[model samples]
Target: MSGDLLATDIEAYLDAHEQKDLLRFITCGSVDDGKSTLIGRLLYESKLIFDDQLAALEADSKVSGTQGGDLDLALLVDGLAAEREQGITIDVAYRFFTTDRRKFIVADTPGHEQYTRNMVTGASTADVAVILVDARKGLLTQTRRHSYLVSLLGIKTVVLAVNKMDAVGYDQSVAAAIDADYRQFASGIGLDDVTVIPISALRGDNIIETGPNLSWYDGPTLLEYLETVEPVGAATGGPMRMPVQWVTRPDPSFRGFAGQLVAGSVAPGDAVRVLPGGQTSLVERIVTADGDLDVAVAGQSVTLTLADEIDVSRGDVLAAAAEPPAVADQFETSLVWMSDQPMLPGRPYLLKIGTRTVGVSIAQPKYKINVNTMEHTAARTLELNEIGVCNLNLDRAVPFDPYEVNRDMGGFIIIDRLTDVTLAAGMIHFALRRADNVHWQSVEVHKEARAAQAHQKPCVVWFTGLSGSGKSTIANLLEKRLFADGRRTYLLDGDNVRHGLNKDLGFTEADRVENIRRVAEVSKLMVDAGLIVLVSFISPFRAERRMARALLEEGEFVEVYVDTPLEVAESRDPKGLYRKARRGELVNFTGIDSPYEPPEDPEIRVDTTTMTPDEAADRVLRVLRERAILPSAGG
Candidate 1:
C-alpha cells in the first residue's frame, strides 16, 4: 500500500462524499497510551498526508516530543500549549481522513481520568470508539471508566485495541486475558457486540498487514476491519428525530426548518409533529443546500418546509407523526460526574439535551455504583468522577426516551449556570409524573381543614446533630409527649423511617439530601394533617435545612441544632461509626472521611452533653409551643 492514494481517485471521492457521508471515529487512551502515534500511524500508512504535511510533522516533532525527533502522534492532536508541555491530549482535535469505502472524521480525545469530560465531547457524535489498553499491563481503572463512558455516550461500536503487543512478546495469553476482563465489564454494562484485537501500533503488526510474529492469531487486520466496519446499523427503529437547528427563509414565499436527522428517516409529504408543543404539519420538501431531495435518512442534514405554518421554532424536534416522545417536566437520570467540584444539589444548572437547553436542579441522588465492585451503594452527593442515578427537575420538561433505548434524545449535559462549564453528562431513565400514587394518605378534609383539626397546629421539628448526639432519643420522647397530649403527631426517626419508607435510599451527600427532602415532604404532609412531627435525623448541611424551612408555611418547621462536641460524641461512640470513620473503614463518612459543615443560627440549640434526653425533649417542646405547633402537654 503505497502512501500515494491522494494522487489517485481517492482525493476526488473524499471531496465528493465528505459533504454528506462523513463518519467519525475517535481514539481515547491515557497519557502514554499512544493515541497520537496510532492516528499518525494510520494516516501515514494510509498515504493520507502529502510530502509537505509529512515534512511539517517531522519539523514540529523535533521541537515538541519528549525524545526530541520523531513526530509523536500526541503532538498531532495535543494542539494546546499546556497540553504539549504536560504531554497529554487535552482538547478534542478534529482530524480528517478517508478510506476506500468511507470518508472519516476523527476526534482524538484525552485519557486522564480527570479529563474524562473531553471524551464525552469527542464521543458524543462518534459512531465508533477505539479504546487502547497497554498490552503488557492490561486493563486499568481508567480503561473501565473510559469504556463505561463510551457506552454511556452511545457509541455503538467499540474496538478494544490492545496496543504494544510486541512488548509482551506478542503473547496470546496476555492479550486473551485482557480481552476476557474487558469483555466481562463491557457485557456487564450491556455494551453490544464489542471486538477486541491485539496489535502493535508502533511496529505495524496486525495493523495494516499480516504480522509473521503472531502466527497463532487468526483475525482481520486493523485496516481490513476498518474497511468493512459498518458504522451505522442496518436498521434504526421508530420515531424520526429531527433536532431543529434553524428556521430558514430563502424567500418570504418559501420558509423551511433545517437540521440533521439523528435517527429514523423522513420523506417529502410525510406527516410530522413538532414538539415540546404538539403541532402537526406536512413535510413539503426535504431541502439540502444543493437541491431538494425526496427523502433523507438518519444523519443526513436537510431542511423541510411545512405545508402549513401552524407554529415551529428552533430547539423543537420534528418527530414522526406516531409515537412522539413523552413530554415530561421531571425525569430519572443516570449521571456520570466529570467535574472536579462536587455536584451541588438544589442548585440550578443549564441542561442541554439534544438541541434543547433548559434549567434543571439535581433533585435526587438515587444510588452510587461502586465501580470496582459493581455494587450499588446509596448516594447523598456525587464527587469527581462518581457515577450515580438522580431525579433531574427541569424548569420546563421536554419529551425523552430512556437512554438504554434512544441515544439521540436520552443523553444530555449539565452545565454550571454560573461558570457555564460542562459539569456532568447523563442518560435519562424515565419521566416523573405527579399522577404517580400519592404516598400522602386519604384525607376527609383538605390541607387547610386538616390544619384546623389539629388545633395545636402541625409543624416539622428537624433535628441536626452529630452521629451520636442523642437525636433519636429526644425525638422518641417528643413524639410520646405529643401522642399523649392527644395531638395528631408522628416521629420520622432516622433508622426506623429508613427501613421501609426510604429503604431504597443510600448514604451519599446527594442521597442524603434526597433522603432529607423526601422526609421533609412527608413531614410537610403530616404537618398539613395538623400533626406535630418530630424528624430526628442529622440533617447536616445548612442549605438543606433552609430548604426544609422554605417548604413549610411561616413558623411551621423548626430547625434544632444538637451541638454535641465532636470529642464528646466520639467518646460516646454508641454505634462505633466514629471509630470506623477514624480508621477509614467508612467511605464518604461525615465528620471523619468528609468535613461536616455545622449550622450557625439554628432556631434552637441544645447541648446534649449537658442536657438530659428529657431536658432536650423539653427544649424541643418549648420551641413547638413557641411556634403554636403544640399546646401544653395537659392541653
Candidate 2:
C-alpha cells in the first residue's frame, strides 16, 4: 500500500476507496500487551499516516518512547498526554485506513480490568476482535476477561494475535503452546472461531507481509485476515425493525418517522406493525434527503411514511407485520455494572434500549461470573467492572429480541435516574415467563371509590429525620389526632416494622435501601386503601426518598422534614444508639459513620428543638387541613 495513486489522481483514489466495504474491529488484551503498538503498526504499514504525523512521531519518540530512541510506533495511536506518559491505553482510540481490498476502522481499547467498561463500549459495535497477547507472559487474567467479553457481546469472529515474537526468538513452540491453552479455555466459553497468528508488532513481522523471521508459521497475515473477513454486524437480515428516533413534521401534510434500520429490508407497500401497540399499516414511502428509496436495508438511515396516520412516536418500533418482535415487561439479562457506585437492587433506573428509555429496576443478582475461573458465585450487588445475571422489571412492555438474535433490539444501558449517568450495560436473554403469566385482575371498586366511601382523600404522610429527632413520636401523636377527628389512619414506625417485616435486613447501605423500598411499597398500598398512612423512618439517602415520592400520584405524597441538629438528637439518644455507635458497637450508623442527606425541599419542616412533639403533630394537622387533605375545623 502506497500513496502514489493519491499524489497523481485524488478523484480516482476516492472512487477506489468508496467501492470498498468497511470492517470495524478492535484490538484488546491485558495491560502492556501492545494493543496500541499493533494498531499503530497497522496504520504505518497501510501508509495511512500523514507527513506531519510521521515527523511528530519521530520527534516525540525520543522523549516518551519505550523502545531505545527508535520511532515508537505506539506513539501514533496513543494520542492522550497521560496515555503517552503511562505507556498504556486509557480510552478507546479509533483510526481509519483503506486498502485496495477494503476500508477499515480499528479501535484500540484499554487492557486494565478497571477499564473493562471502556473496552465494552468499543467492542459493542465491532464485527471482529483482535486479542493481542504477550508471548513471554503467556496468558493473563485480563486476556481471559476480554475473551469472555468478546464472546458475551456476540462477536463471533476472533483473531488471537500473539505479539512480541522477537522477544522470544520467534519460537514456533511458544505460539503453539499459547494457542492450545487458549483453545481449551475458549471451548468452555463457546468461542468457536479463533485464528491464532504469531507476530512482532514493533518489528512488523507477520503483520503486513509475513516477514522472514516466522518461516515456520504458515497463516494469513494480520492485515490479510482483516481484509478478507466478512464485516457483518450483530444484526443483519432478520425481521425489519427501525426504532423511531424522531417524527419529521416539517408540514402537516408530510409526516414521517425517521430512524436507522437495524435489521431486514423495508419497501413501500410492505405491511408493517408499530410495536408494543401492534397497530398495522403499510409503508407509504421511504424518504431521504437525496431522494425517495424504493427499498432500504439494515444500516441505512431513512424516513418512513406510513400508508395511514397512526400513533407512532419516539421509543416505538416499526417492524415487519409477519415477524414482529416479542414485547414484555420483565426479562432475565446479563448486566455489566460500570459505575463506581455499587448497584442497589429495587432502586429505580432508566433503561435505554434502542431508541426507547423506560423505568426499570434490577433484582438481586442470581450470580456473578468469575471471568478467570468461570465460576458462578453468589453476589448481593455488582460493583464496578463486575458482571452478573439478574432479572429486571420494566414499567411497561417494550418490543425486543434476545441479544443472541439481534444486538440492536436486545442490548440496553442502565442509567441513574437522578444524575442521568450511565451506570451499566445489559443484554436481554429472554422475556421472563412470569411477565407473560402475571396480569392485573380488574376490580369493580378502585381507589377512587374506596376514598369516596371513606369521605376523605388518601395520602402517605412521610416523616423523615435523624434518629431520636421525634419522627416516630410526632407520627404517633399525629395519627391519634387524626383518628379522634373521624379520619381513618395507620402509623408505620421503623423499629416496629424491623421487628416483623424487615427482620432480615442489617445496617449496611444496601440493606437500608431495600428496607426503605419495602416500606414505600407498603405505604403505597395503605394509601390505596383510603386511609391516611403515616411513615416515620430515618431514610438516609436522598435517592431512596425520591424513589418513594415518585411512587405516588401528584399531591398524594406529603414529605415532612424534622429539622433537629445531629448533636441535639445525639444528646437525647432514646435507644442508646449514639452511645453504641461511638463505642464501635454499631457500624454504618447514620449521623455517626454513614451519611444522611436531608430533603432540600419538603412540604413541611418542624424544628423539633423549638417545638414540642405535640405541637409538631398539631402543625402537621393544620397543614393537612389547609391542603384539603382533611376537613377544616371551621367547616
Candidate 3:
C-alpha cells in the first residue's frame, strides 16, 4: 500500500471484469439527443444485458407510457417515474456493466440548461466525457456548455459522439460537415483534444461494428473507442492527498485519522504530513471495513494510525512530506455561479476547500466570462451559472495548488451564507503576487524617526469626490505647501496612489470597496507613525468614509469633498473617462455609469470649478489647523 503499486494489480482488476478496459465512459447530451439510446445500444449490442433487464425495458416500453417508443431507451436508463415522466435526468443515474475486454460505469447526466450543475457533478470525476451531439443539428449551445465544463472539470479525453446519423440517411457528407463544424466550435472554446465519431445508436451502425453504409470514415467505432482510449490515472497518481473526513478517536481506544484518498497512493510506513499544521508522523497502519490492505490508491477510503501522537484532525489533509500545497488566509480563484442571488462585497459565505470549511467574502470579482463568447466583462456581481475570476478573502489558511496543477487541493465549493445552499464551484488561481516595489524596502530613516525629526505632527487630509473633480490637484498643492512650510508629510493622491499603491486593483463595485478598504488601512498605519497623510480618492461612499474615520484618532481623519456638480465633473473629463462612461463604453463609472454617493458632512467643501487648486488646498490645511491635528495655522 506504499507510494508505488505494481501496474499488474490495476490491469488484473480490469481483466477479471471480463471487459475491454478498467475505465467507464458516460454520454451526456440534451433531451431526445439519443443519450439513453446510445448507452442502451452499447449494452444491448455488447450482449451485457441480462434476460430480466431486457424484459423490464420491453415491459416498461409497451405499457404506452412514453410517446415515441416501441422501446424508448430513455425508459430503460431513467429509473425514477418522475424522471421518465419528465424525460430528463435530474440526478446521476449510474449503470454498471462489463464487456469481454473491459469494465464500465455509465453515469447518465441530464441534458437541460438548468441541470448543467448536475452535468458538472457527474463529469467531475469522470475519465472520459462522451458529449453527444445530434448529426442533423450539429453543435448547439449546450454542446459548447458541456465542452467548456468538461475542460473546467479536468476531463481532457473527450468523445464527440455524433448520434442520430440515421436521421441524415447515414450520409457521410452530412456527418463530415457536422463533424468539421463541431470540431471547429469545440476547438474555439478549449476543446482541442476532442475526437468526433459518427454513430447511429438507433440503427446500431458504428456502435459495435462498422456498417457498410458509412464507408468514408476509417476511425474507431464507439465500442472500439471505449475499449482502447487509455484511462487517465495520472491525476489519481499524484502526490498523496487525503482530505481528513474525520479524526476517529471514539472512546480514545485507538487514536486515528479517517479519510478518503482523493489523490495518489498511500501505504503503511510512508511518512505523512498533517497540513495547515505542518505536523509530521510515520504511518503506523492502514485500516478499513474490508480487513487490511497493504496499500491503498486514490479513490480508497481508509483510516490510519500514526507512530506518534499529534493534533491531526478533520479538514486537515494528509500528504507526502515532500510536496505540500500552498497554505494561506487568502487566494484568487475562478468561480461558476450556481445560485440565483448574485455575489456581493463584504458578504460572508462558507467556503469548502477540500474537506475544510471556513467563512469567506468575495473581496472582488476580477472579471465575468461570457459563456457564449468566452469574453470577460469587468464584473462586480456574478449572475447565475456565470463563470468569473474573483479574489476571495478566506478566514483560514488552506493547503492548495493551482487547479491546473493539483485537482484535490485547488477545487472548492462556496455555500450560501443565509440559505446554506452550495452557490459556486471554484478553482483556485494562486494568490496574486505582490508587484515588486523598488522603493518599498530601501529607506534613509525609519518612518517614526522621520516623524520625530519634524515634530509639527502628521495626519491625513482625506478628499472624497466624484471623478475629475480636482481631488488630485488639491492634494498635490496641499502637499507642496506643507513641504514648503517644513512640515513632515506625504501626498497619497487618488490617481498617484492608484498607479503606485493600488495598480494591482481595478474599478468594479467590489474593487471600489477594496480600494477604499486598502486606502483606509494604509492611512491608519501612516497616522500611527505620526506622518501627515494626504489622501484624495473618489471615496464615494460616505459610509465607507465614516468607517475610515472610525479607524482614525478622534480628529485624525479629514474629509474634503470637491463639490463640483455632476455636469461640471463630467465636462472636466480629466482622462476622457467620463465621456466613455456616458457612452456606456465603461461600466461602474462613478458619475454616469454608476451612482456616486457624496459625503453629507465633510471637514471642508471646495467647489473645484469655483476655486483655484491652491485655494482649495489652503482651505483643507486650514481645516486641519482648526481641528488641531496640525500644530498651528502659522507654525
Candidate 4:
C-alpha cells in the first residue's frame, strides 16, 4: 500500500476507536497461570498485533518460549526481558484494542506475591477483573489475594477463567468443583456478580471463539462478555467536585479555575462552593478551548469562572454548594503500604488527595488485614505490601468524601517528603469526630498576660545532643541557676518523663520519634503555662526537631545543641550505654548503632569539652539575657 493510503487507514481506525466507549479491565491470578497468554491471545485473535510484531514474537519465542515449537502467546504482553526469560509477568502491561463492538484497555498484572502493589495500581482503575485460575491447581493463595484486592478496589464485576483446561483433559467435573469453591469464597467476600468460564489459553479455546471441547460449558466467550459488559458509569448527577489543577489567568480580565470534573455537572449560573473555606459563588462561565460550554459533565476538562472573586487556588476543590464534601483535618482511612520503609506514627509525610498536597502524619495502625485469611491482626506498623487501618492527621483541613461514595475525592497517596517516593495509597473511611468537635477555646488571659505575670518570656529550652554529651547535666544546672534568679522553671529530664509519659515506647526509630513527639507536646503546654520548660533529651531526627520548632511561637523554642565530640562522649560513657552497645547488648543505641543527627542551626551551641556544666549553664543564661528571654541583670 502507498504511504498516503496507509495513513488514511490508520486515521480511520483511530477515529473509530475514539468513537467507541471504553472499558478498562485487568487480568490477574497466581504466577504462571497464563494471565499474559490470555491477554496476548485476545490481541492476536482480534488481529490487533501488527505483522512485524508477530514476526518479532515468533523470532523471540524460539529462544525464550516456554512452549516448544509453538508461538508463546505470553511473550506478547510480558514485554520485559526478565519476564520473558522467567516466563512470568513482573509489571502491569496495558494494551489497547478495539473490536467491532467496543474499545478495551486491558491490564495484564503480575501474579507473584511480592508484586501486590503493582496489582493494586492496575486494579485501582479497572471496571472489571478477569482472574485466571489454573485448572489443575484449582484455587491458590494468590488467586484469593488478587480477588480480595479487586473487591477492595470496588470492582463490581468478576470473571473467573478456569484456564489450562487442556492440561486437565478438559474435564467438566474439575472445572465444576473449582467454580463451586470459588463461588462460595467470593460470596463470603461480598463478590455478588461473578462469571466462571473454562478455557485453555495456550490452545486458544473458548477465549476469542468457543471450541467443541468446551461444548458442555454454555456461556459467552471472554471477548464476547468483554465487548458487551457495561462500562463503569460516570458520577453524573452526583455532587459536583472539581479539584483545581491550575489557576489560569493569562490576561488581567480573565481568571479561571481549570480542572477535570470528577463528578456531577455544571453550567452557567450554577451555585458552587470553594471547599475547606466554604466560599459560595455562582458559575459565571464554563470555558473550554473551542468555546464556552453550555454544560460540562463528569470527565470533561473545563475552566470555570466565578461570578464573585473569592479565595480559590490550586489544590482547592470546588463543589456543588448544597452538597459540598466534608471538611476535616483528620480521618480514619484504609492504607495500602507500598514502600520498603515501615510506616511510623508521628513522622510527617506528604498526603496528596485530588490536586492538594498537605503535611500529614499516620497514627499507629489500628489493625492489619491478613489477605490470605481475611483476619484482622493488631499491628503497630505497616510493612511493604500490607494493608491496615489508621488515622491520618493533616496539617490543615481539606474537603473529601468517603471512598465508598466518591473514589476521586476520597482516594489519596502518602509520599515521602524527602525522597518524593510514594509510600502508600489510602482511601478515606470517615472523618474523625475530634477533627470537627475539638475547637480551641478562646481565653481572656493570653500568652502575653501569662508571661507578664511570670515576669519572664515563656520559652522552651530544648537541649539536644548525643547521649553522654552532658545535655541533661547542663540543663539541670541551667534550671537551678534560673530558679535562683527568681525565674519560674521546670526541667523535664528524658529518663524521668519516659517513666510516666513515654513508658510504653522503646528505643526503636519509631518509638524514639513518638517519645520525642510526646515530649514536644508537653513542652508546648508548659510554655503556654508561662513557665521556662527545660527539655533535655537526645532528640535525634532533624525532622522531629523541626516539628517541635514549628509548634512554638517565634523564638519560643530555643534548640540548644551541646557540641561534644563523639570520641569524648563515648569515652565519658556516663550512662554506660556505649559500653553496652559495644558488647552488642543494646540495639538502636544512638552514636553507636543508630544515628544521632545534630542540630544544623541551633539557637545555642555549647561545647562541653571547653566548658564545665556550671559554665555551660552560665553561657546559656547570658544568651537568654542577650535575646531578652530573661530580664536584664540590673532590672
Candidate 5:
C-alpha cells in the first residue's frame, strides 16, 4: 500500500500521512543494549532513510563499525563524532518515521548510567517507553533504573524488548525467565501495562517481521504492536487549563492571552478563572494566526480574549471556573536529581512549572529510592542520578494538579538561581497540609510602624568570612558601638546560636545551609522589631547568603565581608579549627574540606590583614551611617 501510494498518488500519500496518529516514544536501557540499533532498524524497515543518509551510514559503518566487515546499523542513529568514536551513545538522538498505520518520533537515548538525566529529559514528553535489554545481560542495573524512571514519569505503556536473541540461540527458557523477573520488578514499581518480546536488532529477527529463529515465540512483531497499541490519551477530558505565555496586544482595542491549552477544551463564552489569583471572566474569543477560533482543545496554541478586562499576565493559568487547580506554596514531591552537585536542603533554587518560575527551596529528603530493590532508604541529600522524595517550599503560591492527574501542571524543574542551570526534575504528588493550614495573621504593628517609633530604620548587618577572619570580633565591636549610640542592636554569633537554636544541626553542607536558614529567619524577626540585627557566621555558600539577603527588603540587608587570607586565618587560628581541619579531625571545615564563597560585591569589605579589629568595626559603622541605617553623629 505504501509503495502504490508513493508511485501513483503523492497527494494521497501526503493526506494519509497527515491523518495518521503520532506516537512519541523513547528507547532506553543499559549501555551497549542495542537501543540505537533497534531505532535504526525501525527507520530502515519503515523506509524513512534518504539515499544520501543511507550512503553515509554504509560508508561510515565500514570505518567505525563494531561489527567487523558488516553493516553496523547503530551508525544510522549514533551521529555524534564522540558517540561514533566511543562506540556508545553520549547524547539523545531523535528520528522521525512513518509506517502505513502511524507516524512516530523516536528518541534514541544514551544507555550509560551517567546519561540517565538525558533519558529523563527525553521521556518527559513521551507517550511510550521502549526499554531495550541485551538478552545476554538480561535485567542489568540500568534496565531497572530506566524502568523505575519510566514508572515515575507516569508512562503507562512500556515495551520491554529483549534484544540479541540470536546471541542467546533463541532460548525460550532464558526469555521466559527474563520475562518473569522483569514482571516481578515492574509490578513492584507500579508498572502494570508492559509487553515483553525477544528480538535481535542486529539481525532484524522480530522487529519488523518474525524471523525463523523465533518460531517458539508467539507474539506480534515490534512494529505491529507499536502500530496497534493505543498511545496514552491527552488531557482533553480533564479540567481546562492554559498557562499564559504572553499577553498579545496588536492594536489599541485588542488584548488577548496567548498560550497552548494543556488540558480540556475552551470555547467562546466559556467561564474561565485566573489561577493563584482567582479572578473570574468569560472567554470572549479564541484567536489564532489563521483567524479566530470558535473552539480550542488541548494542545492547541491560541490567543484568548476575555469578556471583562482582568489582571491576567504571563505565568498565570486560565482554568475552568468550577474546576480550577489547587493553589499552594508547599508540596510533597518526587525529585530526580540531575546535577553533578548534590542537592542542598535549605538553599534557594528556582522552580519552573508551566510558564511560572518561583523561588523555591528543597527540604531534607524523606528517603531515596533504591531502583534495584525498590526500597526506601533514609537520605540526607540526593546525589547525581538519585531519585528521592522531598518537600518543596516555594516563596509564592502556584496552581497545580497531582502529576498523576495532569503532567503539565504538576511537573517542574529545579534551576540554580545563580547559574540558571537545571539541577533536578520533580513531580508533585500533592500539596502539603501545612500549605493550606498556615496563613499569615494580620498584624496591627508592622515593621514600618515599629521602625518609626524607634526613630531608626531596621536592617540586618550580615558579617560573613572564614572562621578565624574576625567576623565575630568585628560584629561584636560594631554592635557595641551601635548600642552606645542609643541604637537597639542584637548580635547573633554563630557559635552561640549553635549551642541553642542550631544545637541539633551539624557541619555537613546540608546542615550548614539549614543553620544559615534558621539564623536568617531569626534575624528577620529581630529586624521586624526595629532592631539592628548583626549576623556573624562562616556563611560559605553564596546560595544560602543570597537566601538570607532575599528575606529582607532592598537596602535592608547589608553584607559586610570580613576579608582575611586563608594563610593569615590559619596562623591566627583563634579556635584551632584550621589545625583540626588539616589533621582530618574536623570534616566539612570551610576553607579545608568544604568551600567558602566570598562575596563578589559587599557593602563593606574589612580586610583584617591590613587593619585592626577596631578599624574594621569603624569601617562598617561608617558604611552604615552612609546607608542611613543609623542617625548621623550630629543628630
Candidate 6:
C-alpha cells in the first residue's frame, strides 16, 4: 500500500479503537497448561499481528518451536528468550489486541510455583482471570492457588479454559469432570461466577471461532466471552476517595490536588473531607488537561481545587464527607508473601497504601490458608509464596476501606527498608477493635518529675551478646554499681523473665523477636518510671534491636554489644545449648543453627576475651557517668 493509504488506515483504526470499550484480563494456571498458547491463538485469529511480525514469529517458531513442523502459536505471547527455549512463561507478559466490538489488554502470567508473586501482580488490576487448565492433568495446585489469589484480589469474573482437549481426544466427559471439580472447589472459596469452556489452543478450537469437533458444547468462544463480559469498575457508588498524588501549582494563582479517582465521583460544589486529618472542604473545580470537567467519576484523572484552603498534601486521601473511610493504626489483613525472606513479626517495614507510606510491623499470623485443601493451619510466619492472615500495626493512622469494599483504599504493599524490595501484597480485612477502643490514660507523675526526685537521668542499658557471653553477668554487676552510687536501677535478665513473662515462647526466630519486643516494652515502662533499666538478653537480630531502640527517647536506649568469639563462648557454654545444637537436639539455636546478626554500631562494645565482668561493668558505669546519666563520683 502507499504511505498515504497506510496513514489513512492507521488513523481509521485508532479512531475506532478509541471508541471501543476495554477489558483487562489475565491468563494464569499451572506450567504446561497452555496459557501462552491460548493467548497467542486469540491474537493470531483476531488478525491483530502485522505481516512482518507474523513472518518473524514463523521463522522463530521453526528454529525454536515446541511443536514439530508446525507454527507455535504460544510464541506470540511468550516473548522472553528463556520462555521460548523452555516452552513456559517465566514472567507476566502483557499484550494488547482489539476486536471490532471491544479492545482487550491480556496479561499472560507465569504458571510456575516460584512465580506466584508475578501472578499476584498481574491479577491485582485485572477485572477477569482466564485460568487455563490442562485437560489431561485437570486442575493442579497452581490453578487452585491462582484462583484463590484472584478471589482475594476481589476479581469477580473467572473463565476456566480447559486447554489441550486434543490430548484427551476431545473427550466431553474429561472436560466435564474437570469443570465440575473446579467449580466445586471454586464455590467453596466464594468464587461463584465461573464459566468453564473446553478448547485445544494448538488446534485453534473454541478460541476465536466455534470448533466443529465441540459441536456438543454450546457456548461462546473465549474471545467472545471476553468481549461481551461487563466491564467492572471501581466502587463508585460507595464513597468518593482519591489519594492525592501531586500538589499541582503551575502558576502563582492556581493550586490543585491531582490524582485518579479510585472510588465514587466528585463534581464542582461537592463536600469532601481530607483524611487522617478530618478537615472538610468543598470541591471548587475539577481541572484536567482536556480543560475542565463538570463532574469526574472513578478512574478519571483530574485536579480538584478546594473552596477553602486546607492542609491537604500528597499521601492524603480526599473522600466524600458523608461516607468517609475509617482511620486506624491497626488492621487485620491477609498478605501474600512474595520475597525469599520470610515475614518476621516485630520487624519494621515500609507499608505503602494508596500514595501513603508509613512504618509497619506484621504481628504473628493467625493462620495460613492452604489453597489446595482450604485448610486453615496454625502458622507464626509466612514464607515465600505463602498466604497468611495476620494483624498489622502502623506507625500512624490513615484512612482506608476494607479491600472487599474498596480495593484501592484497602490494598497495600510491604517493602523492605534496607533492600527496598517489595516483600508482600496485603489486603485489609478490617480494623482491629483495639485500634478504636484503646485510649492512653493520663498520669500526673511523669518521667521528668520522677527523674528529678531520683537525682539521675532515666535510660535503658541494653546488653546483647551470644549465649554464655556474660551479658547477664555484666548487666547484673552494672546495675549493682549504679545502685551503690545512689541511683535507682532495675535489672531484667532474660532467663528470669522467660520463666514468668515469656514462658510460652520458644527459641525460633519469631518467638525470639516477640520475646525481645516484650522486654523492650517493659524496659520502656521502667525508663518512664525514672529508673535506670538494665536489659540483658542474647537478642541476636539487629532489626529487633533497632525496633527496641525506636521505642525510646533519643538519649535513652544505649546498645552495649558484648563481643565474644563463638569458640570461646561454646567452650564456656553453661547452658549446653551449643552441644545440643551440634547433636541436632535443638533447632533455631543462635550461633549454632540460626544466624546471629550482631550490631554494626553499638554504643558500647565489651570484648570478654580481655575484660573481666567487673571491668566491663566499670566501663559501662564510666560511660554512664561521663554522659551524665548518673552523677560523677563524689557529687
Cα lDDT listed for each candidate:
0.79, 0.92, 0.78, 0.90, 0.91, 0.90
Q: What is candidate 2's lDDT per residue for 174-204, written digit by digit as tens?
A: 9999999988888889888889999999999
What is the TM-score of candidate 6?
0.94
lDDT, candidate 1, 294-353, per-residue tens: 889886899888998778888898999887877887888889888887887775578998
Task: Report the C-alpha lDDT of model 5 over 1-635, residue by residue, as the tens digit.
Answer: 97799899999989988889888899999999999888888888888888998898888888998888577889999999999899999898888988899888999988888898999999999889999888888899999999999989988789999999999899998889899999988998888888999999999999988989999989999999999888564435788999999998889899999999999999999999999999999999999989998799998899999999899989999999999999999999999999999999989999999999999999999999988778999999999999999999999999999998989999999999889999999999999998567779989999999887776789999999998999999999998898888888899999999999999999988889999999999999999999999999999988888889989999999999999999999999988988998999999999988989999998889899899999999999998888888866555
Tens digits of per-residue lDDT for model 3, 451-535:
5667656667788888888888888888888888777787776677788778877787656766787888899888766788888
Clash tally, candidates in order = 13, 0, 11, 0, 0, 0
Which residue runs of candidate 1 sit more than 4 Å off their true CA positions?
Answer: 1-20, 66-71, 232-237, 249-252, 433-635
Best by lDDT: 2
- TM-scores for every predicted model: 0.68, 0.97, 0.66, 0.94, 0.96, 0.94
Superposed model 2: Cα runs more than 4 Å off: 1-4, 231-235, 632-635
Candidate 6 per-residue C-alpha lDDT over 1-635 given as tens digits, one digit per residue, 9 for 90 to 100 = 32344467988766666888778899999999998888889889887799999999889888988888478888998899998788889999999987778888999999998899999999898989999999989988999989998999999789999999999889999999998999999998888889998999999988877778888899998888998987454336767999999999999889899999998899999999999899999999999988999999888899999999889999999999998999999999999999998998988899999999999999999999988788999998999999999999999998999999888999999999878899999999999988557789999999999998898989999999999999999998988777777889999999999999999999878889899989999999999999999999999988889999999999898999999999999999898989999999999988988988899999999999999999999999889888889865444
Greater-lDDT candidate between 1 and 3:
1
Predicted structure 6: lDDT: 0.90
Q: Between candidates 2 and 6, name the one with more favorable lDDT.
A: 2
Model 1 alpha-carbon miss at residue 133, Å: 1.7
Q: What 10-residue stretch in candidate 5 is worst by lDDT?
A: 230-239
User: Best candidate, TM-score-wise?
Assistant: 2
Least well predicted 10-residue stretch by lDDT in candidate 1: 1-10
TM-score of 4: 0.94
